[model samples]
Target: MLDLTKLAQQMQGMSQQLTLEATATRQRLELAEKLLSHAFSRQNKLTTHQQTWHDRLSFTAAEPVEPLNLRIAIPVPPAAHTVIATDGSQIAPSHHEIAYCYLINVGRIILHYGQNRLPLLDSLPEVFYRPEDLYISRQWGIRTEEWMGFRRTVSEAVVLGELGERIKDEGGGMRDEKRQNRETRNQRVEAVASFHPSSPIPHPPPHPSSPIPHPSLAMVDGSLIHWFLEPLPGEARDRILPPVLAAWDQLRTNRIPLVGYVSASRSGEMVNFLRLQACPYDTPDCMTHCSNQGDRSPCQVLDPLKDAALWATQLEPGQRSPLWRSSARILDLYGDHRIYFCYVHVGTEVARIEFPAWVAEDADLLDAALSLTLAQVQKGYGYPVALAEAHNQAVVRGGDRARFFALLEQQMIRAGLRNVGTSYKEARKRGSIA
Candidate 1:
């Protein structure tokens, strides 16, 4: 029923629009493909770059430079040892919920490796929910959710530190009848805290000898350096740093070495060090390599490559990269516990391990920690077993979260507190007839 001329005009307009879009899209696709292809050319160059710079690459650190291609075999693990691993989990504030609060849970496990893979004492899911616990004040100067993640880590350290204190209190003795009578080589005293719903913190039980905790390596789940890096100046810094440092002090007082295990790290410290070698001569060469207009060298090409990727091919199973002091800024705060790192290959991927400067300074401590870590990795196939246990205990599931809120609601109603209801969206998700 439409006029033929009008219909023809409308079709012509549609065709023009489609043609313009196609032309623009085609150009964009061609440009993007060209750019992507050009980027790969650099990685190819690094793969073929001269091997001389690789020898003298480390300069920023005071320690001797380890060759980029160097790999050392892992030492044999001791016959019997203990690993105390601590891990943390958190639930950030949710709009679908009642209160403007977040919760953090820390899990710790102490395992002994001499007799029968015995696990001694473990603290599971210690929850925190205080006004001071919930949010970081504007004064902390940290943008990371009022330092929530940082606080969670600090809490984990605090718990471990408390354990160290208790060990000292008990004099590391097995004189207690419960520990003496236990059939298994490893004995456990389990106690967890819940401040809410009015639960009291339990006292430390008698020491279990299965895994003598003291003189053992205290392992934390993530990077020790990363947590200490949260920028808090003046009083804010003072407020947060003490708890972690105290934990370190306590563990060291008990003769326990601290080890931090990071799986699948995206750090570029190795790659950055390697870049120093790839530079033509000095700092200028390094700076020029990053410049857009400079002669694009292999140094520039290797920019996107991660240390994990570079070290993966260079390291063999059970072999480790040479130790290097971390150049991270936060390390300046750790007076005696300055951090050092090395990579260990577990037949699958290279995992980064970090330890204190004191641990590295002593030859025996370093070897003992590394050996124990490798033993755990071997048993676990790749991951450390103690860390695995800590993570398993710390993880807060969705169903568990729901039950927690339900319990909170029940207590709120009993106390005649104002009802805090969930959003309609959540209500619909919970029960929808349609």
Candidate 2:
């Protein structure tokens, strides 16, 4: 009797397992049938001329407007949380190397002397003005029209965060590590080194044998360098030293800002400036030529000090001057009562596009711009076609086949793909047989 009871239990367990397996199989089969029906229906609806037209269009009709390249500058105070979002494909075809940046809670954005905005202002505030608002106001004689484009760019920045968050929330197989690495890179750590100095400072030399550092660092004015490298007392220095060192290490491996010249011809002037600064490193080969004219031409050298001079000139603040604007202007903008600044690079070789001010103030407008931009890119590159294909495949293979079929039917009706007299119920009924 005990053996008989054990056998019966085993049989019951097997029966349950078999039932589940059969149910899963049935669902998969139904899904396949539904997908076939949907495809067939679509094919039937499209006349031969429509199919030919679609084939000929080839998704290249929606080319994006050529990107416009402009320098953008935003004044970030010490320790402010600044978020910068960049989309490479939005402005042009992505070439694998795209830059993104984020700045965190710092001081007020200096619109003009004595005007500023509070740190951490929301993207959209219901009340345009408040007594304690720290944002730079146009009423203070700051130019608003010039900065309007920057605001639109920042609103789009939110899209980067959204894309990141979506990837984090949705876990898939194999690509998890890649997504994590991207998130890690996007996170902005607090900067330990300060760029502002309170007192007169001493000059620090570069390590004796490092390659000429990027020209941008070389061009940092003496005053700015002193401020950036301002000394902290023993205890404070010890506390921040580790992070500063880490940042320095990261900068070495990553693309630190290189000095940009107003013109390729002025490179020699920059080289001379670096020599005066007494930097020990070599000049970049790309910036200057060998001075030795005889049979023995001196090995062309990079002048680090000159590079720094060029960098400083590039970073200088002036609207009309050739040397004053760097690429930073593409990131800052002006708006009603406040100035919005971003420092992310968003552009392509063809054109570097910046945002308009109105879009930045309105979330809906920002979304619309992104959607439109994405659609344009998709039309040009066939990205949307790939996405549509993948989505169709997933719907066809997903569990709950009946529900999937019902949804497809509803879509068809909404799309006006079928006659009003024929309900989804009728189409679905006919679909199963066909």
Best by lDDT: 1
For each candidate, what TM-score against the reference? 0.71, 0.17
lDDT of 2: 0.26
lDDT, candidate 2, 329-361, per-residue tens: 112221121211112211211111123333334
Over 277-315, each residue of candidate 1 has an lDDT whose tens digit, in order, gives 345554423333444555455444454445565566557
The residue pairs found clashing in candidate 1 are none
Error of 2 at 396 (Å): 36
Candidate 2 lDDT at 57 equals 21
Runs in model 2 lying further than 4 Å from the true structure: 1-136, 172-434
